[model samples]
Target chain A: MRYEEFKEGIRDGIPICLGYISVSVAFGMTAVLSGIPVWAAVLISLTNVTSAGQFAGINLLVAQGTYLELALTTLIINIRYFLMSLSVSQKVEENMGMGKRLATAFGITDEIFAVSMQRKKRLSAPYMAGLILTPVLGWTGGTLIGATATSLMPPILSASLGIALYGMFIAIIIPPARIHRSVLYAVLLAVAASCCFYYLPGLKKLSGGWSIIIITVAVSALMAWKFPVSPEDEEDE
Target chain B: MEQIRIGYLLGGIAVMAAVTYIIRMLPMAIFRKKIDNVFIQSFLYYVPYTVLGAMTFPAIFYSTQSVPPAAAGCAAAVVLAYRGKGLLIVAVGAAAAVFAVQLLMNIIIV
Candidate 1:
């Protein structure tokens, strides 16, 4: 049973691997373009497995930003994953120990958490191992392809494909937004809050990391206040 | 351009990986018991959508060369995603739309 569940996790990770390739290709190109070593680029993907945080870290590194700044920026940008894991932690198999839980948490990217949460029961070790395996392979593998293929890749192609990662982001939210009016409203609120943070004369000076923190927390808080989802509303992801 | 010092680069990655990993690990490892708090549950439930949205818009609008192609790509994604296409298909659709528009725009400019 555990093996089957593990296999299912790997099976579900297929599309995510594809999406990771498209996005990580851009990151690989960006890292090399920024003059980062290919090994470092791949290492970032291997260790971090985060898109926004890696991008932000790379940008800061290129600009020779302070170490404190870089770390804080990464923390803030990847903060959402904390929430993701918190939710997933609740759903982790009760028998699972701290070690295995930590191992599973290492794999808790946004998509992984979402799919795992959709499971009807507490997540099992085999299932999580299977789920995380392909995407980890995909993430590092894509980075390798990107970092090495730097010379052959056309600038235009890389730029055009940059949209693919964002496209995946669209895939995540749109269905929920469409099916749930509250989600739609939360999305709109997030966008509106983001725009204000971007454009408002006084607020515009806030850094990207800080703004993301604000937008995520504020919009979620407001939605929770106004919408107040019942236990069932939050059911099955 | 001056390159980032090698030590700093490694340190930065370590910091990022450590912090990001810790942030993820702490919750998953420590939260052995379930939270019965309603507000926190509701708040956590909405966090994913809000974060995705906060990342997408405004950022997506400028991800490409200009608004026209980027808009084309995003519109394709939104439409296809709304229609329930798989993520892989949606991403391909968006990238292809942007590529097509960019090609035409290049031709027009030249």
Candidate 2:
């Protein structure tokens, strides 16, 4: 076990935790505004670390969306994690046991996946724990602060901080898109696809959760076909 | 019972957590062997970028009090991040940009 890897993983996760805390703070405010109790709001963040899925789930709960609707909506929104987990699994050392693997899987958010993928070695249990620890706490911790301090938090500050999570994501993707043509293509195609879903009335009627699923899968497949990664790029796995 | 009720809320969160965990768990547990397929590997590689792209668009534009302020924040993130700033700096800068624009807009509108 490389204590070095674990330390490095913690360092890498700090930014993610910062990003997560701010957004989950926004979510915390949202839950409070929606009449969700503070404890329940924190519970949601603790159990489900996903940004979109929790937002959608809370919206559904607020609007009285059926259980089937809740389940199906989250299922679609979280499908991206499956792809991430698969890619991450290829990197994880095979000697890892099932119980440890499950714990690691619980923590596989988009930021974690991105940071983990950049590692040029087999992902280890300790490294993943290091990666997972801060973000998980940041997410739940932010929610706690947000939920408990709604009256104290200025509306404008909470509102502004809401976009920080997406900012982190933009920061993550834009660098690669700027440097790589295929990545740029994938990014553009995804935007176009998302716009269509948003603007077209027939499609506009579809939920945001559904739009993400269709656009992500289709654009990823097209980019994969159009620009298959070279051997050198796949070296870490 | 309505979803807003405590019982429903608990049930809903449990179900959502279960679904999310299963989605994340099954792939790692099932795909034990090294996957050699080029197409699949590429597809997985592109998944993160594409997903982030789709989620960011249109939504980020509407995430704040109004579109212009949100746009300013996103632009700040893009510009700062393009210049290779740290993630904390980029995110904080974006939020500060949005807050500043929002403050200015309130001054103008009032």
- Candidate 2 CAPRI category: medium
List model 1 lDDT by residue over A132-191, tens digit each. 989888888888888899755576776688788788789878988888899999999898
Write down the DockQ of candidate 1: 0.66
Candidate 2: residue pairs that collide = none
Candidate 1 Cα errors over 4 Å, as ranges: A59-66, A114-122, B1-9
Pairs with steric clashes in candidate 1: none
Fnat: each model in turn: 0.79, 0.81
Assess the local accuracy of residue A138 in candidate 1 as a C-alpha lDDT between 0 and 100.
87
TM-score of model 1 (CA atoms): 0.88
Top candidate, metric DockQ: 1
Interface RMSD of 1: 2.3
Note the Cα lDDT for every prediction shown: 0.83, 0.86
lDDT for each residue of candidate 2 in A133-170, tens digit (9 for 90 to 100): 98999999999988888755688987898788778888
Off by over 4 Å in 2: A62-66, B1-9
Maximum-lDDT candidate: 2
Query: What class would a CAPRI assessor give candidate 1's docking?
Result: medium
